[model samples]
Target: MSIASSAFLATIPSPDRGVWEIGPFSLRAYALCIIVGIVVAIWLGERRWQARGGTKGTIIDIAVWAAPMGLIGGRLYHVITDNQLYFGEGRDPVRALYIWEGGLGIWGAIALGAVGAWIACRRRGIPLPAVADAVAPGIVIAQAVGRLGNYFNQELYGGPTDLPWGLEIYRRVSPDNPAVEDPLGGVAINDVPVEVVHPTFLYELLWNLGVALLIIWLDRRLRLGHGRVFALYVAGYTAGRFWIEIMRTDPANEILGQRVNVWVSVLVFLGAVVYFVLARAKGPREEPETLRSPDDPDYPDSGDGGAAGSPSGTAESDTAESGTAASGDGDAGTGDAEAGGPATRPGSASSDVDTGDDGAATENTASTENTASAESAPAAGDPGAGGPPEKPGSST
Candidate 1:
């Protein structure tokens, strides 16, 4: 197809160039897209994790391990699955290490990235399932963003299409050697068009974003935890991937006349669904206190209630002091009565009795002793001696 005809067809044009040369450095849009996606994933994961009662910087710390491992894992999957592209008789095997050229398998990236996350979780004394649940939405969003790289690279397109949203594929040639057709290290020239194809990358990008929103909504509504959110994400992504994988026209290894990814997606989706259902037995979301390490400053101690400086301990001490003071006052009143003197109650005017004769003083002392004895008597059949009254038949 000619550029003039494609321009009149209302199709999405592919990027004219995916790389830029600046003096001594080269910048590839694919790499930039990947970097931007990683940053977005980390920022979003940190926010979600903190909201879920995780430590503030825990996501960032885990990303330091997961991101690198994910990249390596993605590259390895691509090379191993498409071994013919790198290990063929005429192909350069070194090209397998050129990740900037664009090709990352999401399945491999997730599988190996989880290993890195597990290691980080273990070191920080955090549960891996909680971390996975917190970051599931962010991971899907990152995948959506990374799909833009596939757009710029003019790769992962489907068979020819006449739809309005069809992607225009322009022939690319090496900038230094115009005669050499180099898709990865080349730039489109002469405004020419080769074909217009279905934008499968765009389809997957939109599907991924939709799945992210779905996961977030379900997570909030159902309060999913213990890796259920992550499991749901996996199931949702693979469901879309199963259809999208079959639509792609790219050369790939096949099993039973079907693409290998289609088979992988089916198995993974079943596994995720099973895990999601069985995970219900794990109980509800973890509380904030349980998410913290024992050494954390805000961590709740087991001995908090009776600690010396704690509120409950201070209250107990005050009650004991008050009881001792009351007992001392009771003993003083008894001693004064026994010595044949009127026992003057502290804060009572009636205690100021006339002591002109010994008989009057003896009478006052005897009356005080009788009143004290009556006031000190317990209720009938009370279990506690001189204690507060209780209703009949009530247990202590």
Candidate 2:
């Protein structure tokens, strides 16, 4: 085909390169996309987590562990299930570990990521189901963003199409063996002058976005909790994956004549549906745990589910605020402790006593008897102040 003919097709073109080098470091579009997706997930998760009474750092901290585990799980699932691609007679087994080349199973990632998250949640004394419910929508949004990596990799696209929205795949050639045909097709697409295929990645991306919106909307409207929201997310995502996986023309393992992923999606969707239904009977919504960072004053710590005040002992802690703290009054004036202790007011510190009975010095003590007697005493000029002046004669 002529260059003018190719230009007339007007299709989305794949990136010329998926990786670039700067200094000694190599940056890969696929890896960058995953990293950005994880970051977005963590940011959004943090908001939802806070709404659920979780602390600020919980989402990021859990992600730190979940991301690597998910990556490993995804790669493990891909290599193990699709071993033929890398472990085939002529293929190099080492390439199986080349995750930057783009092959991650969402099912495996979620499963393993949840395990990692559970560990983090356990350490923080948080329930895993609660955390799962909060982050469900954000997780799907991250998956949506991850599809961009497939776009750059020029992989996981659908069959040939002539539509205006088709994705233009560059000529795929077998460098090691020119005789080898493209795994996606029986024929050598490299010989073809031009190849335009359906942009299945975009299809899945849009679907994931829709799923994310649906999960969020349902979560808010239904007040879904106790992991039901997470179940809904699983169901919604698998529903989309079932259809999208069918559209993809990439090389995938087949089981019972259909893609193994399609079966997995069906199984997963059923599990999610059952869980969502059963969870409804358990409760409508989870009580957001009032338990949060004990140190974070701004974070909520009350079980009341309202604007939280101070820590757990806040109301009770006012005991000290109401009055000056009780301590031995050592000195006549301030009673402040010197190097040894409060500068003793003569014999006062010996047994919680006060040297002088003037209401001034006695007030420093925690004693009830002295405080009451001092209060009863009247001024010198008052009737009761002199205590019957003639009574002094009888006592003498």
Candidate 3:
């Protein structure tokens, strides 16, 4: 007898099916969820990137490389860790190629996706740290959305529970081979037509959302930079993943009496913490106005554009032009000081008299003029010059 009538509990219910087939095309909820998450991440990341002074279209371009790389990496990690699905004697090896059915590891996705992002960023000359900081919160929220796919797929839930908001799960039949039951257990038939399980996916979704908010708040308050905000995102996500992994009853590989993911979470979290501390000591937030990617040296650092190799690019030229103009002086301080010394001394008599800090420059100007005039003055009684003007007709 089915257990549907044996129990009554207030709880969240898992979707009946996550796959939809139309005519010749099949649309999967899992894949759709992942796609939506990626789109949202890019949209949010672009906004944040622009706010950080990064050029538009940069995020979209990077995503072109990153998204595919992440999918491949995520699938690779899942297949490698769960090789039984393909590598075992009775298991079909080609089944590993079918990614739409579900399974993607977050760690592998991040690690390999970084490689693609680095390649794209190098081409654009945008600093990876700056991009990472901008994209961190968006990435977390994307993970939150990805968890919804798991709920739809009826996967990754925890042990039986009777909580008010517990997830009511159903028996899941394998999409690949209907003859075999899903290796990952579903709700016990004895428990009910629907049995409540701890909604581990939902817990993770909420956790990721919370972590994203925490990062945004901290980024604003402390002004974290040098990829520290990204590191914090990693640490924060892994911290939650550790506890959540423990609650999950899924048959993950074991290491030292814990799930493989648990160990990964701990190690990654520690590395993130260490990196955050070290990176902060490296520097403050980058001045966004002058941001230049590694490959684009010709990018201007000031208002008046100049080729990096040109003399005009040097600070001196720009200062002479803009700084002098802004100060309303044709000749900047040094040039004017030299030329107008004698002329200026007569106008500001106190300029010569005063010897305090402010007046020191004026005193120096007057002294310089006096020295020049003395050197040019006629020697004592020599012919046409000094002692007395000779009587015009007399040859002294």
lDDT of each: 0.77, 0.70, 0.72
Error of 3 at 374 (Å): 17
Cα lDDT tens digits for candidate 2, 115-232: 9998988787666787898888888989988999887777888998878888877655443465664332122343232578989889989988998888888888878778898998
Better of 2 and 3 by lDDT: 3
lDDT of 1 by residue, 99-136 (tens): 99998988889989999999998888888899999899
C-alpha positional error of residue 320 in candidate 3 after TM-score superposition, expressed in Å: 6.3
Indicate which candidate wins on TM-score: 1
True lDDT of residue 386, candidate 3: 34
TM-score for model 2?
A: 0.70
Q: In order, what is each prediction's RMSD in angstroms?
A: 11.3, 12.1, 13.0
State the weakest 10-residue window (summed lDDT) of model 3: 387-396
Q: On a 0 to 100 scale, what is the lDDT of residue 339 in model 3?
A: 33
Candidate 3 structure, TM-score to reference: 0.75
State model 1's lDDT: 0.77
Q: Which model scores highest in lDDT?
A: 1
Model 3: per-residue Cα lDDT at residue 346: 21
**Which is the winner by TM-score between candidate 1 and candidate 3?**
1
